[model samples]
Target: MNKSNRRKFIGTAAAVIAVGTAASAMPLSTGKENYPVLHHVFFWLKNPDSKADRDQLVQGVKTLKKIPSIQQLHVGITADTEKRDVVDSSWGVSELLFFKDLAGQAIYQTHPIHLEFIEKYSHLWSKVVVYDIIEA
Candidate 1:
């Protein structure tokens, strides 16, 4: 290759590498907030078709938001989608809770509001699955 072509190719390669390095180092979250711990819970209700049961569960979840240690809370119902082999729509309700750290989550676990929530709403769901995640 001629000197001009070689110089252009080298410059292009250096630009690509610089862009990739900067992208990889960028923070994933918005600068205003940082939630490192995530607690996800899925609930399979005893009577999935009953609106009363769903409403009761939703109400119970709202009370949980009052807990001081919880940074964020989201409660949702499973969405209707195309039936597929991999889809698992058995869960009637899903809840996501975010905390600043594991210590905050620990406090939430034993908080009176959380315990009260369980006592009030445990009988509505037959199965529950919880997944906890920490940011790397």
Candidate 2:
């Protein structure tokens, strides 16, 4: 995708990573605390060619911001631009979420809104992948 075009994947890997990422952060030996976790989720749709399915997924992701524990939420899709050897374009939709701390993330997991989102939208995707990053 071009710089002007923006969109964003991990598949079956998502659910496992989402839960594990918060639990698996490694602190620097210097003792700096990990204050925030960046949770990036990738979704490969069962009907990757369907615009309706992809749009619905993106909208569903937007609803996650209602959860108080989520500091930020961004919904995106695959971009149409240059394909690099390292770029992943298999997924149709992606969400980048921010949480203040692991506790916040844990709360988000059980939050009614988050649960509802999964129940309502899980069927759209055939696979999910999640990546969690903590600032060094």
Candidate 3:
């Protein structure tokens, strides 16, 4: 290879290695005591019939957002993007909730607000998936 080409290749390889090392060494979360973790729950609707079910689920998730224990609540409708193997995007809606701890999450789940939401929108979707992860 030409001298210029060899230099460019070496520089690119070094840059890649540096980025990979930095990413691996980065800390997950700040060193705060009892750092809060985010709980993500997704609902996959088998029936993609009409706007009615989506609207109901949105309203129910909004009610959940109003509860006190929940630090954050986010509802995401699947985007028309490239598919990934991990998520089964055949469903209609995905709900994400964040809490300080398991106790807080449990309260959110069992609270009257959440119960009411379930009663209202439970039948709209056929399947539900939940995922919880704590920051390191």
> lDDT score, residue 60, model 2?
96
Q: lDDT by residue for model 3 over 5-27, one digit each (tens)?
A: 99999999999999999999988
lDDT of 1 by residue, 59-107 (tens): 8888999999999999999889999999989999989999999999999
Rate residue 106 of model 3 by lDDT: 81
Model with the higher lDDT, candidate 1 or 3 = 1
Rank list by TM-score: 1, 2, 3
Which runs in model 3 stand beyond 4 Å of their true positions? 1-35, 84-87
lDDT of each: 0.94, 0.86, 0.80
Q: Write the per-residue lDDT of candidate 2 for residues 17-119, one digit (tens) a residue.
A: 8778977786548754345788899999999999999999999999999998787888899989898999889899999988888888889889999899999
Q: Give the clashing residue pairs of candidate 3, or none.
A: none
Stretches > 4 Å off in candidate 2: 1-35
Stretch of 10 with least lDDT, candidate 3: 30-39
TM-scores of the candidates in the order shown: 0.75, 0.72, 0.68
